[model samples]
Target chain A: MALVEIKNVRKSFGALEVLKDVSLTVEEGEIVTIIGRSGSGKSTLLRCINGLEDIQDGEIRVEGQQVHGQMKKLRELRQKVGIVFQAFNLFPHLTVERNITLAPIRTGRVSKADARALAEKVLAQVGLSEKIDAYPEQLSGGQQQRVAIARCLAMSPDLMLFDEVTSALDPELVGEVLKVMEDMASRGMTMILVTHEMAFARDVATKIVFMHQGRVWEEGPPSELFSSPKTPELKSFIGSNH
Target chain B: MQNLNFQQVLRYQDEFLHGIVNTLEMTAIAAFFGLLIGVVGAVLVGSGPKPVRILVKAYIELIRNTPPLIQLFVIFFIFPSAGIRLAPFPAACVALSIYFGAYAIEIIRSGLASIPKSQVEAGECLGLTRFEVFRYVVLAPALRNIYPSITSQLILLLLGTSVASQIAAEELFHTATFVESRTFRSFEVYALISAIYVALVVASRVIFAIVGAVAFRWPVRR
Candidate 1:
């Protein structure tokens, strides 16, 4: 079974329909890159997968378990899926260590010592093992984003979602965040990301999905999709990225 | 002004001290309850279900719209007639708490609102339940951000305690009236109590500053 699957998803913000009949699937260890223009419903779909946003119509399943409206079930699914945002929404009032351990410890998933150990582990993974005591505001944007990723990794999530994680970083800082994500992708983590970094997506994505007008316009292995575009929108989108 | 006589006012020194103590006690207790009500009411109004939220909104509106004096009258006079026999002191405390709680609700709601939406979303994405998110991430920063406003409200409530004298609570102002009636030292007694109220306000502000500093020693920036 696919690690992440969406079936006939429909979402709208009152009168404006953002996602109209969206569907996709990701097998375990698949790195799916979703590339689209700003309003292509890429981030909304990511939010729905984690049950952050309620769907008007459709089904989302993670690891073959249906994700829906039940609070407990959504939480259970959330434990397996982690999402990092473009804003790097670290709890500014908390230390890097507290930010990472809060969820695991507060939810009683692990003891404080274990959570501390997990924080250390993930921080090391993100190359920020020494910055555990720093506050979010004190860190550079790339470091904060990396902490957010480390914060998510502390939960030991089976799947990770990155919603334009590097979009908010400075051009100089983008490389560091992308490097962290590239490392995660190399480690066989099943991941879906919405990114404008075409080069990084070209190199790391096992599957590249081109979204246009709130639907998947073209999707396949990155090799086939990039070398032989099937849709004019995909061709133009790819052209514009260069 | 006529010649001032400190000696006459000093004769009621014990009474003045007693009143000042009473005033401090009433303000402390009422402020505690008022802060509690404000925090709880703010949380409920911000996140409670539609019906309860509406009820909270109504209560805040009702309390805020009417005069504090009227609210005191209802609590002190009407409630007893309705068989809820509260003593003058307790009634004064309750009245001030509910009255100030309305303003507190508004103050704290704006404080809570000042918290970025990203903070709440981060907490939610971390799988925290609704209440837990509010308690840890949202409430801490919200309270911190609004501490200055809340402190001002608290001091204002403390000053507003002068109105409790109408119910014969015998706090500082009431004692001043009693002393003035006995000694005919109207200006002196009133002036003394006014100075004492100022001191109390200053003292309470220092206390709140200490609390704001200590309680929020943790790292929370807006």
Candidate 2:
């Protein structure tokens, strides 16, 4: 079975249906890149996987635990899932190291010293070891985003979700963040990212899911989808990017 | 200004000093507990069960709607009718704490609301429990945003402590009244009291500012 499973999920905001009949699966060690235009529900789908957003119909499961309703069940599932947002969302009051270590420590699964060690390791992974003591405000947008990723990584999550993580960075800073993500993929982390960087998707994704009109319209190996253009929407999306 | 004899005022310094102490004590107690109420109300009422949330909302509205002086009167004078007698000082603190907390609840709760929902999402994604999210992620940034507002309300809370003197709590303002009756120098006494009040207000701001620096640990601007 796949690590994550969503079966015929539906979500709506008042009268507006945001996600309709959305179903997908993610296997272990697969780097799946979800690509789409703005408001294509790419970000919403990623949030659903982490139980950040509710699904009105069908079910979402991570490691076979239901991801809908019930707060305790959601928190239990949340431990295995790490999500990085475009906003960075670093706790403004905490130092960078504390931001990274806090969840790990609160879980009581790791000691304070161990959490510190884990923070150092992840910070180094993102090439941000020097910023251990600095607060989020002190860093550039890219740097702060990197700290956010390290904060997620410190939890040792089984699956990681990225919601348009590089969309908020300046063009000059986008490469560094994409590079870190590419490195994570190479290290065999199971990552599903909703991103706009088609080039990066092509380079790093094991599979690319093209979403159009609230559904996974086209999905395949990066080479196949990027080259063959399975649907008119994918073709135009790919065409527009170049 | 003819009766503004500096010598007479100096003679009543001991009484004035004692009143100043009472005012400071009651105000400090009120401010401290008011802040506590604000924090607890903000966190609990935001995430609480429906009935609990409604109860909190009612309290917030009730205190906010009524004048604080009447609230103080109720505690000091009215409650005794039902046999729940409170000393004047404690009664004053209780009234001001509830009254100040009403405005504080609104301020801090809005500050909590202003925290980007994504930050709370990040906490949950990282698997911190709800309480952990409130304590670490939600509260500090929320309070940091409203620190200035809190200082302003605190100075007001201190001035309101003078109202406690009507119940014979003998706070700074009350002591001024005592000295005024003795010297018949009403303007002189009040002017001196105002200076002292200003000094106290300035000191409170500095203290809370230092606290903001330490607790927020973020730069002045978010």
Candidate 3:
């Protein structure tokens, strides 16, 4: 069975529809990068996978359990599937160490005594071990983003979703965040990212999906999709990004 | 401006000291209880059931729209007619606390609203429960965001304690009234009490500043 399955999901916001019949499947240890213009429903699809947004129709299952419905069920699904947002929404009142350990300790995944070691391990994974005591505001944008990833890593999720995690970073800072993600991908972590970094997508993505007009316009290996453009939308998108 | 004679006013130093102690005691109690109500009311307004939300909303509206003096009157005078009699001091405390509560609720509610939705969503993404999200992620920052406004409201509550004088509560203003009538040195008496009020406001500001510094020691985002 696939690690994540999104089937015919339809989501609407009042009069406007954001995602229409979006279906995709992600196997374990696969790094899938989704690229599209803004308002193409790419981000919405990522959010729905972890039950962040309620779907109007269809189903999303992570590890064979349904993603939406009861709060208890969504909480269970969220534990297995972690999402990092565009805004590194770290708790401003807490130190980086406390921010990382809060979820693990609260969910009973780790005891208070072991929380310090758990935080250190994840912070090290993001190459930010020295910033364990620093607050979110004390770090640079890239550092904060790395801390956000570390916070998610602390959960030990089976799948990670990156929703434009680097979009809010400075151009100079973007590479550090991408490097951290590349390291995670090399470790065989299953990650699905919504990003506009065409070069990084081509190099790091095991599979690249092109979404246009609320649908998957094209999807294939990075070589095939980038080398030979099938749809005009994908071709134009690639041309514009390059 | 005429003949300022503070010497006569100073003769009643004991009475003035008693009044100062009483006012501070009442203000402390009212402010503490009022803050408690404000936090609980803010939460209920944000996420409580429909009936509860409406009930809290109605309470906030009712107390906000009415005058604190009249509320005190109701508690001190009207309650006695209805078989609920409270002494002057206790009646003043009850009325002042409730009065402060009404404004505190709105102030705190605004603070809660000021927190970005992304902050709460981030907590939810971590599999924290709804209450946990509010407690761990939302509450402190929200309070921090509105720290100034709430503290100012607390100062206003302290000033509002003067209204309890109308009920013969023997707080600062009530003592001023007594001394003024006896000494007939209204100018000196009013002048001295005005300085004392200013001193009290300054003292509260220093206290709040210290509290704010301690509670929110984390660096703020630029």
Give the Cα lDDT of each candidate: 0.89, 0.88, 0.92
lDDT of 3 by residue, A79-121 (tens): 8778899999999899999999999999999999999999999
What residue runs in model 3 are displaced by over 4 Å at the alpha carbon?
A: B1-11, B81-83, B181-184
TM-score of each: 0.96, 0.94, 0.94
Q: After superposition, how far is residue A32 of candidate 1 from its true place, in Å?
A: 0.6
DockQ of each: 0.58, 0.74, 0.75
Please give the range of 10 consecutive residues that has the lowest summed lDDT in model 1 chain B: B213-222
Between candidates 2 and 3, the lDDT winner:
3
Query: How accurate locally is residue A49 in candidate 1, as Cα lDDT from 0 to 100?
Result: 88
Q: Encode model 1's per-residue lDDT on B55-140: one tens digit a residue.
A: 99999999989999999999988998889999899999999999988898899999999988888888888888878888878887
Write one digit per residue (lDDT tens) for candidate 1, span A161-205. Answer: 999999899999999999999999999999999999999989999
Model 3, B182-209: lDDT tens digits are 9999989989999999999999999999
CAPRI tier of model 3: medium
Model 2 per-residue lDDT at B149? 85
lDDT of 2 at B41: 89
Scored by TM against the true chain B, the candidates give 0.93, 0.93, 0.94
